[model samples]
Target: MSSVNTAIQLITREQAEQGATAKGSTCSPALAKGPWDYDLAEALAGIPAYGPGASSADVAPAATPRQGQLPEAYKLASDAELGERILAAKAALGDRAVILGHFYQRDEVIQYANFVGDSFQLANAALTRPDAEAIVFCGVHFMAETADILSAPEQAVILPNLAAGCSMADMADADSVAECWEQLEEIFGTEPDAEGRVPVLPVTYMNSSAALKAFCGEHGGIVCTSSNARTVLEWAFQRAQRVLFFPDQHLGRNTAKALGVPLEQMPMWNPRRDLGGNDAQALLDSRVILWHGFCSVHKRFNVGQIEKARKDFPGVQVIVHPECPMEVVDAADSAGSTDFIKKAIAAATEPTTFAIGTEINMVNRLAAEYPQHTIFCLDPVICPCSTMYRIHPGYLAWVLEELVAGRVVNRITVAESVQDHARTALERMLAARP
Candidate 1:
């Protein structure tokens, strides 16, 4: 990753020169500030361009759904025009609608949010807005699903763009998890030990589908966020001999390792393989059975990137989210959630160089917010969460304006049956003290 950074820096510098060339004439100054004009910036940065008519050469092919059928008029509307329209619609809705923006969302969309937070924080935020008729989630699919499960039945949860989904969440489906559970039951009998503890307990990461959350609830388990994972695990182990953690192997591994679980006791479950690629002995001895899934964005950070930041900036503080690979988290000065990272920067009284490993949008926003501290992303590549990027200003305006007209577009509803169990799991997570 460190070696790749030099190449990215050279390319970005060249792109900056090109951007300076066409600065005032074609490129809006707003483009210079992010909510990056992805097309132009990608073209200039030697990073392949994406979004509407993106070529095959784009660095990673855009797997996320195309932006929904936005009004043709929005395509021609200038940024100022869109901004005015969004503001007008939001004003029209008033307290009837509360917009929730995730940290990974573009600044343009985030600007209109009533509140902004990570998945767990946003869940709590949803509870606070019980008076609102609609909860417009400016994040991904699973997040909206969680909100639907937690929010009042009368309060509709809306996802502006139906396409905004989490890649990591999609990796573990409910059916696969169910099958794995059955196999585990066969290996480690459903009976409890002498202390009356169950053989194994299910602990799904919050970055998972609502169905998985429901599974956890039905089986006497709870949901865990990156921030509260350790506490949640402690809560789990009190009633179970072993734990089965899913959707993100890295987080489970990192957290369990901290709790003194040996490497051999933590086995990775690959769903495609028979018995999840584990023998009966491995299953019986396992303290934490980790599901093979990871965040593509966090997985990009490496030990090399941390080393490079240290070499380049003397005494630089490296902070990473636990979602990062174990080695990267091990290399960092500290590991914490998005809010943790924000508070760390806020608490820094002296001039400090901070290198962060997380989503680019949040890191960039932090750097902008805390100018006294030299904040920079470990990865030089101009990559944002591809799925979160799906919620462009156009989608936001479309959804809000629809609500203004007494119409609900892109509403996300968890089935009543699923919601019942999922809500229980979420409530358990919220109650667990960290």
Candidate 2:
């Protein structure tokens, strides 16, 4: 372990030693917490930690080309100008490059992306582009990491801006996950396997670190997105007695709930506590191991918003991603991924309206695409996920210029070790899909 990691691990050990007896975070669960939670120092503290300043296996040297902060870089005039230049650079590189854009991406970058979809779709898309030498990810850092994990080893996945990351995904990490699993074992002995042996599965959402994906792969889990959550969960349940789902509790819970699992069967794992800080009742009856994490964006939607939207547009179908708070999802007529929302809207025979409770960009894009449908975000006011918004056109332009210059900026790479674990988790899910 590096010195910084050693110290952070010391802190965790110190806290574990003292229990809740020491200084506890007294802030309301409502206190705003997001991507700014930097535990880089803590990750460094873990035993067998990587080299200096490394938190996870991802702390690679600055391998991608520099763009945004480079002094001599040419200043592109407008978003359009940047797009033109990016296209020009693509032409310069010729035939070996492809771009993947997330549904939440800004219009400027999305227009330039060769493939646009949610994280699950992007992960699959990357795998199909085996011939491409480079994959430019026009999304958050986790999405890029997912691309790196999914794409062919020879194909390099590039993130235009290193700073673009998901705050929601950051809420859960390795140590927290490890603690939760240990707790599950304590309570349930071991998850029952097909041969009546014990099985432990760790499933991750696409919006997680490459190491987490590696962790999942290592533990016989699969990566999931809002789109394929149901399939992923089914895959997970079949291979193991239970699954330890990270980063998005709502998605895991909601998906499990949808699959006829009772609310009583799901237990929340609080990384900050002993035996995952799970309630006794939940532990005794556990079927799903839910990490105490949620999406700051989707959690903002409440049942009240759905009610208000329904009153405003009667007969409208309230479609939401399962990542939403339970109340909001319960109030909605339907819940699924971006693909589901789009498909649901398109399948409507009657002129329809929709109150979507996911990211605003996807909602707004849906609104524009289906003019026949009266679609609006469930959020009455326009609030975007702050971190996703950080990948503005300026950043996109800057990154593109570096790519065009035959230099990859913000290259996201998953170490071979972690990649093995993360992919195992994902494949397990794929196999379990009903």
Candidate 3:
């Protein structure tokens, strides 16, 4: 199968000529156009929105960062021209720059990545290249913020597109979280129990903002990734009577469920309502307080898709990201992080059919990598993570060329006040063990 971008173009052309619906493809026709178009519109309209894709429906906060218009030259350049320009710029920058690509990034942008992995893995990879003056993260806003927090002071972390912000991360703002914290404090005081555990310990997923992570750091909390959520939760439980997990409810719920926490013990915290929409008794009895947030891309997957996959391909191994809803995770054969999903397929010896539930880009890449086996995404739609899709090849080329010209654009920097606390929480997570 061609790249999703190519498929979208073809489908769009066919649709215009034949007046036919995209047969098996479900992505919006808007995605058929270049992402730069949306970037320009967002800047002109003075409003921020996750451009066309899975997260298009998500409402971006008014404070959300916006990307400026791309130079017409870059936008007008053909794919081959952009590829050549990016390569030339990379050659000029040499060791001065290192590009990090998230698993969900489009193949066009990922092709130029010095290191490609999940957010945490990419951050660690940037550390390994300490000599590099710039870390170009082709992921979303939160991932770039993470790189800035973890990287050396002199090193600059750059995001290709400022508009490439995670909608899930935006769901839990610093102000909203702080408000929730104050309410929790009123109900469950700062005192520790007889076992010396605090009343509540804050734990923000890696998808959250630096301020939120710093909140965790200052309040005796820790940060967690999808891969290490279990370990982090166990770590939290040992120090506190109850834990507060945020930014991605599905991840928190799924992980806590796996640890045998009763459903009744985990209460969802809605920022809009008082007491997180729960009674005092329920809050007191809660072992894990879940925040109302989720990954829009993962939210698109459902049990129906899994059932369809099973019906179409018998004996297929179904794997989904833990970010998926509880029902979807429960229905799948296994739920793990992106790395876990990739490893599972690599470990398979027999020719197998695999149905994966995650961003379409990574699923498509996996399918291409292992042609011997049959691999397909559970969601037949070509929709990808909206923010990840924002990092188009045009943007990549523009950023690289700017670096070659000794100018830095779209650099992500964490405030000094936020860095220490955020780094503390991250360190606690690193020390946490199963």
Candidate 4:
């Protein structure tokens, strides 16, 4: 990864000379209540049924569902029945449909995945597959939206459950982003630029909304997943003097600081704050302004847990994701994305002991995959990414069976206009390659 940085620097330096451009948005000084940080109650809601304007809630936290029972259609069906349905769906859809699954998906669903990996990898996977016309994205809404942006114009992307959205992504919506931009412009001018030709680049994590992506697309911005944050940031630096990273402030702060940015230069933007997260002194002094947002799942891990892991197993390698709280990341040996974790382990030559600050299922699976090596999750708590957990095997079986039938249920489509802007942002990252 360090070796890749030199090449990134050179390409970005060349791009800086080319200039920054924001083409579509007439709201030159873009404007956003940034999004709420968390809403656990949203997870309790079952995935809302699809079509236009739908919501899923098992019950309001203030209340409860009508009964303990899920829908009768949701009763656990036999695995064999599911297999048959999947085969029929494949036969019926033939070359027109593809299934994209997240690594966190249950084995039952993973078994049927046309492709399985992290969110960005899944999006890249969806972009290929020339045989498929409709992509059955088996992940959450943010993921499906990413696929829609990456796929061919004719391709139809679908999310089985409309309510299957990512809370992390929800943390930063367009309205809030717009408001933030408006505030920034008020302080820093309509387009904070050195030459007046440069536009402030907006880079969103893949864990954001289709609308957000469109916002980026419309502006001179693009979307990045955890796996490609560094690449995306490298791209942003070329287009603008500063970056406004959304939702996961920790990831933004951690990544920028690691790239040699000083802590004092990294300011947190809290939408709930009076200044829209901008403290004039901090804003003037900083380079990366992280929007106040976080991942409740990763936040669950703590430094104490890492200390305990070290005590339990001496000489264990402690690896974590930047999404973790700063103190937790400070205590770990290293931090990176899910793919980075896998690659680091794979690159290790000898049998090693490892502790990971990430989802337990992935850690457990890695341990099993590398029986010769020892691996464990940092937190002993059994909590999971609850939203990702919503993708139960029951839903998987139903989706596959539905595919086997003659009907195509959930298809995701990012309008071409949105894609046009989104593509510019994505191309910038790809172009950042040395």
Q: Give TM per candidate.
A: 0.87, 0.79, 0.99, 0.79
lDDT score, candidate 1? 0.81
Report the C-alpha lDDT of model 4 over 1-434, residue by residue, as the tens digit. Answer: 11111222344444455534522211111000000111222334542221111112111222211122223454444557757667676777777778787866545566677888888788889777866877877777778877888787667676665445665676687788988877766666656466543445688887777777778877777777676788778877877777778978889887887788898888888777877655687776767888887776687789899999899999999999889998888899998888889999988899999999886557766887787888877766444454554454455545556666545555556767767777776666566552
Better-scoring candidate (TM-score), 1 or 3: 3
lDDT of candidate 3 at residue 11, scale 0 to 100:
78
lDDT of 2 by residue, 235-294 (tens): 767677677888889999999998998887787877778767766556766778788877
lDDT of 3 by residue, 130-216 (tens): 899999999999999999999999999999999999999999999999999999999999999999999999999999999999999
Q: Native-vs-model 3 lDDT?
A: 0.93
Task: Enumerate residue pairs that collide in model 1.
Answer: none
Q: State the lDDT of candidate 1 residue by residue for 1-434, as single tens digits.
A: 22112233444555667864522221112222222345334445543323321011223323433334556676667778889999998888889999899988777788889899898688779889889999999998899999888889889899887656777887788889999999999999899999999999999999999999999999999999988999999999999999999999999999999999999999999999999998899888899999998887788789999999999999999999998999999999999889899889999999899999998788888887887889998987556676676676777888888899899878888899998898899889989988
> All candidates' lDDT scores?
0.81, 0.68, 0.93, 0.67
Candidates sorted by lDDT, descending order? 3, 1, 2, 4
| lDDT, candidate 3, at 5 | 82
For each of the candidates, the C-alpha root-mean-square deviation to the true structure, in angstroms, is 6.2, 11.7, 0.9, 14.5
Backbone Cα, N, C clashes tallied per candidate: 0, 18, 0, 21
Candidate 3 lowest-lDDT run of ten: 18-27
